[model samples]
Target: MPTPTEIRLKRAERLLEVAFDDGSRFRLPAEYLRVESPSAEVQGHGPGQKVLVSGRREVGILRLEPVGHYAIRIAFDDLHDSGIYSWDYLHRLGTEQAERWAAYEQALAEKGLSRDPPRRRGG
Candidate 1:
């Protein structure tokens, strides 16, 4: 597996820049990470049960906790802190970002969902 060499948290840009030992790097966005979380809350218990998470265009990463020597548990500002992102998974996410993002957008459109949260009634 291609292990991560470094992870730069660009909080202002809401991005996580991860570099793997194989010379591949990915700038994963906070919203993408939150929606593609490996946690059961997002991935579900089995296949064909993946949930379509929306209204997270502004979510941010609160912190990242290392889990053993394999993965890291991400703590999102949305209070979701269960997904354990491994080196392999993160690499795949980075590589498949374009296709996955396209699918996500299509799913959202089919479900009448929006990436941005609902607007507040009051000022």
Candidate 2:
């Protein structure tokens, strides 16, 4: 796995900038990360059991913690902290961002959902 040489969280831009040892750099949006979280809660128990996470267009990373030597635990602003993203998974998310994002959008559309959650009228 290509280890990250640099990792920066651009709070204002809601982006996580990661530069790998292989000279590859990725600027991943917080919303994308939130929706594509690798947690069992999101990814499910096995293949084809994946859940489509919607209403995450405005989600952001609240913090990140190292998990031993293999992955990082991401705490999202929405209180989701189960996903431990490994180097390999992060790399794949970056490299295949376009395709993944497109599929997400399609899934949401098919389910009559949107990136933004429906707002409650009274609370």
Per-model TM-score, in order, reads: 0.97, 0.96
Q: Write the per-residue lDDT of candidate 1 for residues 32-84, one digit (tens) a residue.
A: 99999999999999998899999999999999889999989999998999999
Which numbered prediction scores highest in lDDT against the true structure? 1
Error of 1 at 122 (Å): 2.8
**lDDT score, candidate 2:** 0.91
Best by TM-score: 1
How far residue 92's Cα lies from its native spot in candidate 1, in Å, is 0.4
lDDT of 1 at 33: 94
lDDT of each: 0.95, 0.91
How many backbone clashes does every candidate have?
A: 0, 0
Q: Write the per-residue lDDT of candidate 2 for residues 30-105, one digit (tens) a residue.
A: 9999888999999999998888988888888899999988789889899999999899999999999999999999
Candidate 1 vs. true structure, TM-score: 0.97
